[model samples]
Target chain A: MDHNKRYEICFSKEKDLGEFLKEAKGLNYSSFVFFEINDVLDIGEIETDFRVFKGIEIHKKDIGDIKSDISTYRSKVDYLAVKARDNRVKEVLSKDKRVDCLVDCFGRRNDFDYVVAENCKRNDVAIEFNFGKLLRCSGYERSMLVRKFHRSLKLVRKYGSPLILTMKPSTVFDLRGFREFFSLIKSIGFSKEDLIYSNNYFKRLIERNCEFDKDEFVEPGIEKV
Target chain B: MRFRKPSLEDKKRYIGFYIESEERLGRKEVLNELWSTGLSFLGEAEMAETGFWVHDCFDDQLIVEVRDGYVDEILAVVSLVNEIKNERVRLDLLGVAGTIRKLKKSFILNQEK
Candidate 1:
């Protein structure tokens, strides 16, 4: 899959949003996933104006497990899911049809159109795996997490919903080319076909949401995957 | 800029340093000499009231209101110390969790530690 096809940008600070919007305007990708922290609500204010802003993702890292002290982590994942739904409900109730999709960063809690399932079960949303984080853990841990992750992918296939593969890269060095991405996916026991499906699904979502013209969408060249 | 492992007795002193960086290192050195101990960092909380500027080093350099002009380096150092202290607290939590898990297993086995 082409690196350009799986483009995603995450913004934590408000200033980065403007920079991202300006940069994304010049890109030829069909869809762009923008993950924003809840504190920076101003980005949402300018959402409609940004032509390339396909979907808005808000991450609430609250997975209420007693083992981890994730308390300080803003927006619990489940709470964020509900909040996104509520926002969607309110938008629809107001008769505003601009917002097409609301994606929950982690797994789904109530009702969400898309979910990013990392080492967890899948529902209506898409499953995204951080291959780097998985590989960083011990081999045993990696295998265990992969088993759970693969199960989630299977659910996505059965449900016939879209799936997206993301690196969740915080820095530029984390970016990978097509070959590296394919090899990493293969190492995690995912088939070539699964990788292709994820790439296509992600592209379609971007195309639909971004409203990119046919000429604007760049077709990613497939490698061995 | 530099970190050293505090002695067992100095743990408490270091904890004080973690909380209050106002004291000079001489005070810490004197405490280490008297008690032969060090302090452990518990954790850090963001100074919500402080205004900060991004420094060239990519660390948040806080603006500490002093007598006249603001001291940027001092605020940055204090913030870093607080961060280290907070990390220590997180480690302490992880340690507690591990201990609890072990105790639970031991209890199930009808064993006393």
Candidate 2:
């Protein structure tokens, strides 16, 4: 599958949100997902907008779950955002269909169904792991984090869709195009085949969610072997 | 903990550090200088009475605790400046003060990558 086919941008601030929405409009990206931290004002206001699929980060209190705060937030969000401590909470939230994506901050766990393995068949939920931050983390922390992330990916593949790779770049300097992204993933232990499948999965999600006139999009020719 | 006066070199580093000062140097030169160095800038009431400022900097995401009487506070500022200069280190200065004593070298260097 052509890696260029899949694309989704997560925006954390209001300014970036406005900028990306405008850019997506011009580019006519078929599907886009918007994530906002729950504290941001006017979160409910964005839900009505058709330009993007909206996901909000809600704390554990908002979701009525005693799991890790991060998992509670993930459960309430359209895209579940899990931090290092929230693995157990994420297990409970995965059962809900409202969660279309699961973002693991430390890339520790990958099981899409059941808190522990052997509960049910796997289902696909988009998973994102940040290589840049992991690389900058302490050597011990990085190795431990990556090992967990890889394990998560294996579990996801066996139970659900393969893991989705993301850079989670907080600043403009962190941005990388498709080629750079593929190379980075390779450096971080993803095989060429895994990279290709991850890209295809993301593209499919975008196509499934984004709505645009067929004529406006120049389908990047992608082939599956 | 017994307070140790900062060495001249430490003082120089604290005073010369380039942080945004609150106002022109006047009645509170030391206070303003500390504030300029990006200390808490606790306002007159907080500064004269408590000798600390409670302000957030670095795009307002960090919540720092600054006490005027504490040399560790100045040292904390120096550490923050160094960490910010090195992009790879992700220490939240404000969060640090809230969670630990600002003066402990180990506390500042705990997560330095």
lDDT of 1 at A42: 33
Q: How much is the lDDT of residue B64 in candidate 1?
A: 18
Best by lDDT: 2
What's every prediction's RMSD, in angstroms? 20.1, 16.0
Looking at model 1, residue A200 earns an lDDT score of: 69
TM-score of 1: 0.37
What's model 1's overall lDDT?
Answer: 0.34
Candidate 2 Cα lDDT to native: 0.42
Give lDDT: candidate 1, residue B78: 27
Worst ten in a row by lDDT for model 2 chain A: A22-31
